[model samples]
Target: MNELQHETSPYLLQHANNPIHWKAWNDTSLKAAKNENKLIIVSIGYSACHWCHVMEHESFEDETVARVMNANFISIKVDREERPDVDAVYMKAVQLMTKQGGWPLNVVCLPDGRPVWGGTYFKKDNWMDILGQLQNLYTTEPERMMEYAEKLHQGIQILGIVEKNHSEAKSNPNNIKPLVEKWSKSFDWEFGGYARAPKFMMPNNYLFLQRYGYQTQSKDLLEFVDLTLTRMAYGGLFDTVDGGFSRYSVDMRWHVPHFEKMLYDNGQLISLYSEAYKRTQNPLYKNVIEKTLTFVERELYNSDNAFYSALDADSLNEVGVLEEGAFYVWKKEQLQQLLKEDFEMFAALFNVNDFGYWEHDNYVLIQSQSAETIASQFGLTENELLDKKKNWEQLLFNEREKRPKPRLDDKSLTSWNAIMLKGYVDAYTALGHEHYLTVAKKNAQFITDKQWSTDGFLWHSYKNGKSTITGFLEDYAFVIEAFIALYQATLEESYLHQAKQLIDYCLEHFYDEEKQFFTFTSRDGEQLIAPHFETEDNVIPASNSVMANNLYVLGILFHNGYYEKTALQMLHHMIPNMDYASAYSNWLNLWLNQSDDNKELAVCGKNALENIRKIQAEYLPNIILAGSTKASELPFLQSRFDEQNLLFYICQNKNCLLPNTSLETTVAALKIS
Candidate 1:
C-alpha cells in the first residue's frame, strides 16, 4: 500500500496498491526526498482521466519501472483536483519546457523541488528510458541539471504575473464589439465552437456572447449562440440516455466525447442553458437543464446534498476489462434487438449507422439534425418525435444501467459544490421551480455547516466527514458568487451577510494589493514553487475573475466603494491581456455590466416576493436584485419598504428613480435601458 493507503483522495487511493512506492503530496514526503538527496518525480492526474488510468497500467504497475522509480526518485502522486496549487506550478513548468501539457503529468524535479524535466503520458519503455537518462545526467552532469532547473523555476515564477494597469482605458461596451469580431473569425460556423478539434463547452464564452448579442441586438452573434447551444445539446457530448455532459468532445463536431463527466462542467453548463432558456424560451435548453440536474442528483449528489468531483471515463466492459466509453456507447445489433419494430425510426433520428459509428463496432449516439428536421423526414410532428425519444431513452437507460457503472470520484470539493449550488439557483430562477430553490438552500446549508469555518475561512476538500486542506481562493470565490445568487433567489439576508463575510476573509488572506488581483491560494495556505493568479476562463471560470465579479455585485448591493473600485481595477489590469475573447470571457462579462450601467432593483412592500419572481422571469443580466417583504437592514433595501403596496426602485450609480408600483413598466424600463 506504500504511503498513500491512508490518504482520503480517491485518485491517491487508486495508486495505493501500485508496484511503485508512491506518496501523497505533503511536507513529510517532500522532506524525505530532500533527506535522501533523490530526484523528485511528481505525477499528477485525476481519477476520471482515462489516459491516467492507461498510464497506470502501462508503466506504474510494471515491476521494472517501479524498481527504477523507487531507486532513483521519490515518487509523489497528486490528484490535480485536490491539489490544484501543486498541479498549476508543475503544469506551467511542463508547458514551458515542452509546448504542451496534459493529464498524468510527469515531472522530475531537483531535491529542493525545482522542476527540471516533464511530459504527459508515455509508454513503459519510454518512461523507463527517460528516468534512466535523468538519473544518469544528475550523477554525471550535476551542474547542467541545476542550471536547467533554475531557468525552469524562474519561468514558472513569471507565468501568472498580473501587473496593474494605471491607464484610464474605459471599460467600454464598444471595446467588446471589436474583440468579439476578432474572436468570431475563429468560430466554426458549422460546428458551433472554435474551429478546432477537441472542443470544450466553454460556458462563460457563450454566456458573455449571449449578453452582448442581446444588448447590442446583433442577430449574427445571437444566432451563433443558438447554433452552438443546440448542436452541443444534440451531440454525443451530452449523454442522451443518461443526462449530463461529458468533459469535452474529442472531435470538431461534438460527435464523440472523451467520456469523463465532471461536476464543474455539468454545473456551469446548467447555468448557461438555464439563462439561454430564459432568453429564447427554447424547450431544448430547458430539457438540458432539467435532465442534467437529474443526473447530478442521481449519480453525483451525496446524501448531504454536496456534489462529488467526477465520474470516471473508463469502466469495465462486457469481458471485464477497463475500456473508455464502454458504458455509454452501444452496438448496432444490440440496439436493433432492443428496439425491434421501432429500430428503423430510432436509428434515423440519432444517426446510428455511419455518422454515429465509433471504433470497435460501437456507436456513440449523435444527432446531426434537430428533432424538427428528423420529424419532417419521418412524416411526424416535432412533439411526436420527442415523445418517441423519451420512450427510447427510458428503454436504453434501463439496459445501460445493467452494465458496470463508471467509477465515481466521491470527494466533495467546496469550489465545485458552490458552482453546482449556483446552477440550482439559476435553474430555479429561470424555471420558477420551488424544489430547485429548496435543494440549493440545502446544499448551501451543508457547505456552511460542514466546509466553512468559524475562523473566517473554508476547507477545500471534504470526504468521510473530514476536511483537512485549507481552502484556496477558488473555494471562497465561487461560494461568495453562489451565496450572492442565492440571496437574490430567496431574498435571504443571512446569505448576503455570509457572502460579505467570505469576501472580507478573501480580502485579508487572498487579495494581492500590488497586482490588484486575488491569488489562487490564500496567504496562510501552503506556498509552492511559484504563486498563481488564475485569470483565463476555461471550462470553469477563473477564480480571480469570479472574485472580481462578486466584488462588483456585492459592492453595489452593500454600497462599498472599495469593493467596487477593486473590481474595476482588476478589470482594467486584464484589458491588455484580453487578446482572446473566450479566455477572458468572465472579465469581459464584468466589463459588460459596467458599460451597460448595471441597475440595482430594490423590491420592497407587501408583494415584494411576488414582484421578485416576475422580475427574475426576464433575462436581465444587468441588474442586482435586493428585496424585503417589509423593512430590512441592508443599505440598498433600507427605508424602501412599505407593507401597503408593492414598489420597484430602479437605481444606477446610487441614483434612484421614483418608486413605481407597476412591474410591467419596470421590466420595460430595464429592457429599454
Candidate 2:
C-alpha cells in the first residue's frame, strides 16, 4: 500500500493496494523524484472512468509490470476532480501533441513537472513496450527528452486565451442566426443528438437554440429543438428502465450507450428540459423532467440532501466476471418470464428484438414508438397501455435488483451540487410545484451550512462530515448562480445579498487584471505549474461565461455601473470569435437577451409576493421580478409599499409607468413595451 490510502479521492484510493508504489501529487512527491534523479509518470483519471479501471487491473496489477514501473519512475496518481488545474495543463499538452484526448491520460514528465510525451489508453503489451523504450531513450539520449519537455512547456503556457478586450462591440442578433442554423442542420433528425457516433447531450447548446427559437418565434428552430429532445428521451441513452440519462450515446441513433451516469449532465439536462417544457408545454418534456428528478432523488442524493458525483459503468455478471453492462442488459427469456401476459406488448413497444440486441444476445431497451400510437394499433386505450408499461417496468426493476449493483462514487462537489440546485430551482419556477421549491431550498441550506466558510468564501469538496480544499473559481461561480436562482424563485433578499458578496470576492481574488478574465484557481490557493484562464465551454459551460452571467444579473439587481462595465467587457471579448459560437453558446446567449426588449416587474405592498406568482406561471424569460413585503429590501422599493393597497409597477431604465392592482393591466402594459 502507498500514501493514497490516506487520501479522500475515490480514484486515488482505488489503487491503494496495487503492487506498484503510487504517490499522490504533492510537493513531497516532486521533491523525491528530483532528489532520486527519476522521471515522473503522472497518470490522471476519475473514479467513474471504465478504461481507468481496465488499466489498473491489466498493467498496474501485474507483478512484472509493477517492477518495470517502480524501478524507473516515480509514479503519481491524481484524481482530476481534486486537482483540475493539474489535469488541465497536462490534458492541453496531450491535445496539442496528438490533436485528441480523453480520460486515463498518461503523461511522462521531468522531475520539474513538465510533460514530455503522453497518450490515452493502451493495451498491456503496448504499454509495457512504450515504458521500456522510454526508459532506454532517456538513458541513451537525455538531451532529446529535455528538448521535448521544454517545447511542450511553452505550448501549455499559451493555451486557451479569451481576448483581454475587443473593439467595435455591437448587439446584432442577426449575426448569431446563421451560425445557429448551420449548426442545427448537423442534427441527426431521424435519430437524436448531433450527427455521428459517440454523441454527447450538450444541454447548454440545446438551451441556447431553445431560447432563441422562443424569442424569434421561429418554427424551424423550435421543431429542431423538439426533435432532438424527443429522440433522446426515447433512445437507449436514457435508461428506459430507470429514469436518468447516461453520459452520452455511443451511436448516432442513440441505441447503444456507455452507461455511466453523471450528476453534472443530469443536472444541466433537468434545467434545459424544464425551460423547454415551460415554453412549449410539451408533455414529453414534462415527463422527462419529472422522471429524471425522481431518479436523482432515489440514487444520487445523500442523507444531507446534497448530491453525489456519479455511478460506475461496470458491474459483475452472473458468471462472476466483471462486465460493463451487467446491471442493465436483459435476456429475452428473462423478459418473457417476468411479463407473461404483457410480454408481446412490452417487447414490441420497447424493441426487445434483434434491433435492440447487443453482445451475447442481451438487449438494451430503446423505444420504438409512442404509447398513443401503439395503443391505437393494439386496439386499446392510452390509459390501458400506460398502466401496462408501468406495471411491467416495475417488475423488471424488481428482477434487475437481484443482480450485482454498479459502484457509486459518493464525493459531494460544491460546483456539481450547485448545478443540481439550479436544476431544482428551474423545475420549481417552470412547474410551480411546491416539492421542487422545498428540495431546492434544502440543498441551498446544505451548502450554506457545510461548504461555505464564515468569511463568505467556499470549499471545493465535502464528504463524510468534512469539507476541505479551497474553492476554485468554478465553485464560487456556480454557487453564486444557484443563489441568484433561489432569490428569483422565492424573492428572498438574503440569497441575493449572499450572491453579491461572493462576486465581490471573485473580483478581489480570482480576477486577472491584465487578462480581464478570472483564473481557474484563486490567488490564495496553492499554485500549479501553469495557471489557466478557462473561457470556452465544454461538458459544463466555462467559468468565465458563468461569471459574466452572474455579473449581468447583479448589475440589473443593484444598478451597479462597475458590474455592467465588466460584464460588457467580457461580452466584447467573445465577439471576435463568433464563428465558434456553438462552443461559447452560453456566453453568446447574453447578447441574445440584450437584443430583445426586456422589462423589470417590481411588485410591492402586502400582496406583492402573491402578485408575483400571477406572472410566474407564464413563460416570461425577458421579465425580471423583484418583490418587497414592506420596504428597504430593494432600493427601488424603499417606500413603494403603501400601508393598505397592493400594486404592480412596470419599470425599465429607472422609468416607472404607474402602480395598479390589476394583473391584466400590468400584462397589457408589458406587452406594449
Candidate 3:
C-alpha cells in the first residue's frame, strides 16, 4: 500500500505507488507552498485520460523526476472529474496563456497560488529545460515573474467580470430564433453532423433542432435533426456490432472514431435518440437507443447500480498495443471466414467493399439499407430477414466480447449520475420498461444516500465506498435537474422537494450576489484566487445554464416569482456570451423556450394523476409536472395514467382550461402543445 491509498479518487489511487510526493488538492498543500515560499505545481487530469496516464508513467513514477519535482515545488494532483471547480479555473488560465489546454494540465503558481506559467505533458528531457528556465526566471527575476503573475491575474479578473455581466442578461426569444437559424445554416448537408473535420455527437444541437422544429412546426428543423441523427446512427461513430457510441469521429464522414467511450456521452446521446424516436416513431432510432443502453449495462454499469465514468481509447491486441479503433476494424477476409455463407450479404449491407470504407479497412456500422432492401437481396420475407439479422448480430456480438475490453474508469461522479439518471428516466418513459425505472430510482437513491455530505451539501464523486471531493456548481445543478426530471417521470413529490432543497443550497452557497452569476465553488470553501463562473458549455451542459433551468422550473412549480426572476436574470447575464452559447444550443433552447411562453401542466388528485402519468409515459420533454402523490407511493403507479372518473385540470400559462378527469380529455389537453 502507498500513502495515496488513503485517497478516494481513482486517479490518485493510480498514482499511489509513484515516487513523486503528490498531494491531493487541498488547503494543506496550498498553505505549505505559502509557508515555504515554494512554487505550487498543480497537475490536473482524470483517471481515463490517456495523456494523464502517459505522463504518470513517464515522469511521476520516475524517482529522478519525482526528486526534482518534490524538491522544487509543492506538487498537487487533481482528478478533474472529482474537482471540476479547480480544473475549470486553471484550465481557463492555461487556455488564456497558451491558446490551448488539455490534460495532464501542468501549471506552476506563486506561493499565493496565482499561476505564473503552465504547459501540459513535458517530456522527461524537456522537463529539465523547462524547470531550469522557470527556476532561473523565478530566482533571478522575481520581480518580473511577479509582474507577469499579476498581469495574468488581472486578465482573469477582467474576463470573469465580463462573463458575469454577460450571464445576467435574459435573451429575447426573437434573438434566439435567429441564432438557432444561423447555426442550422452552417450544418453540413452532404455529411450528417455539424460542419467540422473532427465531429462530435453534439446532442445539444440535435436537441435544440428537435424542440425548435416542434415549437415552430418547421419542416426544415425536423428534417435537419432527423438527418443528423440517422447519419450518426449509421456512422462508424456508433458501434454497429455492439452498442454505444465512441467519443467522436476523427474524419469528416464519421467513418473513423476517436474511440473513447464515456458514460456521460452515451447517457446524453441515448436520451437524445430516445426522444427522437418518440417524436419520429422511427424504429432505427429506437434500436439505437436500446443498443446503447445494452452497452451501458454490459460495460459501464457497476453491480451497485452506479455507472462508471469512461473507457480508455487505447487497447492491447494480438498485434501488440494500438491506438483507438484498433479493436473495431476488420479485414474482409476475417468476416468472410467468420460468417461463411452470410458473408457477402452482410458485407454489402454494411458497406464492406474490397477497398473498405474507413482507412482501407472495414469498420462495420450501418451505412445505408432498409430492412426491405436486405429482405429483397436475400430473397426472403422481411420478418425472416429480420430474424436472421438478429441471430447474426448475436453471433458477432459474442465474438467481439471475446476481445479485450477497453479499460473502464469505475469512479462514480455525481454529474455523470445525473446524466445517466436522465437517460434511464427517458428510456423508461419511452419504452415503458420497469427495469429502466428501477435503475434510475436506485442510482438516484445511491447519490442522495451515499454522496450527501454531513454539512448538507453533495459531494462530487464516490469510489470504492468513499466520497471525498467537494461538489461543484455542476454537481448541484445537474443533479437537481435530474431530480426534477425524475419528479416529472414518477410524479413523486419527494423528488421535487429534494430538487428544491438542492436549488436553495446552490443559491445560498454558490450564487455570487455581487456578480449576478453562480460561482463554480462555494465562497467559504478552500479558496482559489479566482473563482470562475462557467457559462460556456462543454461535453456536459454548463453549470450556470442547468441551474438557470432548475430555477425556472422551481419558480413555476412553487409559484415563486423570485426564483423565476432569478432565472431570467441569469439568462440576461448570459445573453452577452451568446457566442459561447453556440456550442451549448440545448441549454440555450431550454432557456429561450422558457423565456418565450413557459407552460406548466399540474396534475392533481388520484384521477387526474393517473391520466397525466399516461401522457407522461410518452416521454415529453420540457413539460414540468407536479403531483401531490407521496414519494414512497409514486413508484407503484409506473404505468401510464389509467382512464377513470376523476377530475383533472389541464393548466397552461396559469389558466385552467375546463377540468375533465377523463383520460381522453387529459390526453387532448396535453396534445394542445
- 1-673 per-residue lDDT for model 1 (tens digits): 7898999999999999998999989999999999999999999999999999999999988899999999889999999999998998999999999989999999999999999999999999999999999999999998999998998899899987877677875767688888999999999899798899889999889999988888888899989999999999996999988789999999998999999999999989999998999899999999999999999999998888789999999999999999999999999999999999989999998888889998999999988888999899889999999999999999999999999999999999999999999999999999998989999999999899999988878999999888868999899999999999998887889999999999999999999887788889988888988999899888889999999999998898888999999998899989888887889999998888876556789999877887798789789987888899879989888899887878899998789999999999999998843
Give the candidate order by descending lDDT.
1, 2, 3
In order, candidate lDDTs are 0.91, 0.84, 0.76
Q: Which stretches of candidate 2 lie over 4 Å from their true place?
A: 653-656, 665-673
TM-score: the better of candidates 1 and 2: 1
Q: Give the alpha carbon lDDT tens digit for every residue of 1-673 in model 2.
A: 8888988888888899899889999889999999987888999999888899999999988889889989999999988887778888899999999998988999988888888889889888998898888888889998999998888888888888765544565757677777876777677777756788789888988888877776777787778888889888885888867788888878777777888889999999999888888777887788788888988998999899889998888889999877887898988998898888888888888888887887798999888678898888789898899888778777888888899988888889999999999999888877778898898899999899999999777988988888988888889999999998888778789998989999999999999888888999999887877889888887898888899988987887787778877887888887676676668878867766576456778788777766676666566666667777777456656667886887787877667777888888887666422
User: For model 1, what is the alpha-carbon lDDT of residue 614?
Assistant: 78
Best by lDDT: 1
Instruction: Give me the runs in candidate 1 sitting further than 4 Å from their true place.
Output: none
Evaluate candidate 3 by giving its C-alpha RMSD to the native, one decimal: 3.8
Better of 1 and 3 by lDDT: 1
Local accuracy of candidate 3 as per-residue lDDT tens digits, 66-87: 8788888888888888888788
Residue 405, model 2: Cα distance from true site in angstroms: 1.4
Residue 476 lDDT in candidate 1: 94
Best by TM-score: 1
Model 2 poorest 10 in a row by lDDT: 162-171
Deviation in Å, model 1, residue 123 alpha carbon: 1.1
